[model samples]
Target: MNYTADSIDNLGISLRTFSKINLDTVFIYPTVANKPYQIALMHKAANNTYSVMDTYNGVTLNNHYIASVEKKDMNFFTATPDTNTNLGVTFRAFDSLVLNSVKIYPSQIGVPFQIDLKRNGTVVNSYTGLTDSTTQVVNLNFGVYPPDSNSIYNLVFASNPLINRDAYAANTSTIKYVPGVIRILNDTAQGKHNYFYDWKVAAYNYTEPVPVNFLIPRDTAADAYKIVFTDNPGAKRDLGTTTSLTVPDGLTINTSTDQGYYNYFYNWKVRTNYFKFYSPAEALTLFGDASKIYIDYPDTANSQNVMDYTYCSKMFTYLQTVRMRNTLKNNVAFRDNLVSTSNLAFTGALDAW
Candidate 1:
């Protein structure tokens, strides 16, 4: 809640009250973190001498006593700290960082907060929710797209963006707050009006539907091989491997045994199946039958519908003529003849030497 010059204090407050006091170089610290801070409102006098206000609380000192006032040899001031702006942390971008979950620490739980994912300065995704009163850690999660693998990214936390941010000042009030920040606090383990802190993130590298080819080891034994994959679509496989593995048959593809190698290093998650087979014909028949059972690919680059390049009729979109890319030598004879440097004989005589 944004606080205006209201009769009572609220969470979202805007402090725009500028004073003509001679207080400069003022130092402040919170008796406790995320709470009201005591400010040593100071003044200057003869020969530019400095005088400190003798109170920890924000006290309006008399103009006459402003100079010779007894300095309070105590710690801090009793003024609320008002930060009315969006605050958050930034992280360096890596290849395919698919961040879908976010966590933050708000000093005052239960208040609403906005969390956004900024990729190259553009907000590609966001999640907003009220902080749960029971827990200090606020969580916001949703399905999100993978931001550009090469661009910089930042996570921004702010008050409810839906709320309009026009801060009002009440009559006869000098102390104020800035708008944009949403803060709340209680007496126990709290400083001035509480603000948010300690932001944490969990993300993973982006993964796409991969094109994989298994070249069965060409052996004279005509042995059988088993290949298994865990279907982990739309999950952060970049944080090492999230896929479980199993060696189906004693005859294993030595490479596929390690989950990390296939999940993180190789980027393959076989969640749904394993192929145990022998001979190209058997594999082809099984694949054909499996395609009917599971209608996975219709018409995409990753589809199993590979055009038979051996025949001209199957290559519809790509027509193969006698002339290939290398045979695209239009007017090659004429072009080459010009380069040979031939001169016409008796076509013209030298007019001047």
Candidate 2:
């Protein structure tokens, strides 16, 4: 499934007539007919505007331009013409499951490159020849031990030959709380990293049913939760209630579709019990007020007994019991208003009143 795909926007080929030459982009095309380590000449569209051309294609490639898009064994890249130098991720993992590999969605096709998997700012491993020609699911394509505890693991792309990445580019508003999954994106500059993007990873090896709890916080400024896995969920993905999930207004979609694309690319799918959707006490503040937090009322007839927040510390339907607790409990002294003398004892229950 090796390909050299042309961009959809034509990479600045003036949809109308007489437009500026697009020299800022290195259009993706197969290395077929073009020699390896080749330095194709630039195509001068106008007086001083020029774009590179594929060597075999000669000059004037349909009134467009081209530049250096090579198959170099890129151990590192200074900066793309788009200036996307660095991209990393800090996300959660299921404690009970061992990590299989990570899944990354490229904005464009990056045929030959290396991905450095970083845990807490340190390089764990580098996956080479990781190509995503069809703009579908990309993986680390390796196995590693799960985190020592349920914590946030970071990802540093180390190499970003792709641009125009797909993320929730709709409104800068709306921060969603995603449960049982690990996904967080930042619009601001994360350290010296040039950019940020939304990506996902998978975990495996669950001895018993463990809720995949990832305490991911929402970004108050930009759209906190970019997108976990919008379209084309990873192949052989976990069986969770993902179909019923709600999506943001505008989620970026990759149009480079090929029947044989995902089949050629190895998308790492980690085997786990199920994804957990529990929000921690700290994240509950994202809603702006703790008192306004909603809780599911199990008793329809006794809505008055409901608490501000209820947590299922442990739940096992097969075990026929669920352990839950209220985060808020209050006690008050109540005296019988009736003047009639009657010996009474207060059990200190709200319902008894």
Candidate 3:
């Protein structure tokens, strides 16, 4: 519906004097004598801020247009403001949504002026420039982040043109990102076997294209591993005796949520080595008092069986496995005996037994 000064004046005609008047309807009303008419109250427009031009200040407003990320455009005509003799030129409008803030960039070279900011027809903030017609940017309004960050703020540039005759004003809208209300969980899960360690991770962010990294200890200090992922459940592998590893593909989340979150698995295999030697020649052979270097074990455990004899080159293989209990800590042989019978076996006997 269109509203204008002429339409408002005509709507104020007395129905008793005019037979053509639709006085029976609530939409028609007698005008208040000697009072200027105003536009009736109405709901705000969807997804847009209302703006108009003021010819008194040489202001020329163009139609507003909405643009999308896909380069689509939707345009709406600007609503001409109805002048108020009492308040001069005033605009009563609202923005489509909550906003982060507003800023004004003055393009005219004149006196400096203040701009008032509002939302839902309520004054929120105001900003004043330093000098007359300051050809720079100024903040008109500021709001809470993470909440109104994506909202569009309603703006009203109010100035005393009579006092600040040298100032001119122009402003722009700003939108920002505030973290969303999302929770994340990152944890490690133990597998059925003690040799393996599994992990699970999660997180949340406010935007897309998130970067992430995962850190895990190497088998040895000299090894290094770097993982570049683009999706969740990124990479999973068995950490063999090798000390080095590489990151697999498709582990990045790319979203603000779970930006740099990660989880992992590490399966460690305990290692132990054993070796023993002896001779089955004559008792106390020529080379009497035989001696051998005994390499110590990092941890201790009981051996099932071992050999006490050796002839030529005896073969001694090491046995490694997982323990159900703390045998290395409580076993007597693990503490006192350097080598157990099951730990190693010899093919030959000692020259003297």
Q: What is the C-alpha RMSD of each candidate to the true structure, in Å?
A: 32.0, 26.0, 35.4
State which candidate has the highest lDDT.
2
Candidate lDDT (C-alpha), each = 0.29, 0.30, 0.23
Collision count for each candidate, in order: 25, 8, 35
Model 1 compared with the native: what TM-score? 0.25
Worst 10 residues of 3 by lDDT: 13-22
Ordered list by lDDT, greatest first: 2, 1, 3
**Where does model 3 exceed 4 Å of error?**
1-112, 134-136, 139-152, 160-353
Question: Candidate 3: deviation at residue 320, Å?
Answer: 44
Q: Spell out the clash pairs found in candidate 2.
A: 4-29, 4-30, 43-51, 51-66, 52-66, 52-67, 179-277, 180-276
lDDT of 3 by residue, 166-280 (tens): 1111212211111232111111112111100111111121112111111122221111122211111212121122222211210111111121221122121111222112222
Reference-based TM-score of each model: 0.25, 0.29, 0.20
In angstroms, the error of model 2 at 310 is 37
Q: In model 1, which runs have C-alpha deviations exceeding 4 angstroms? A: 1-86, 93-110, 132-135, 142-144, 160-353
Point out the higher-scoring one by TM-score: 2 or 3: 2
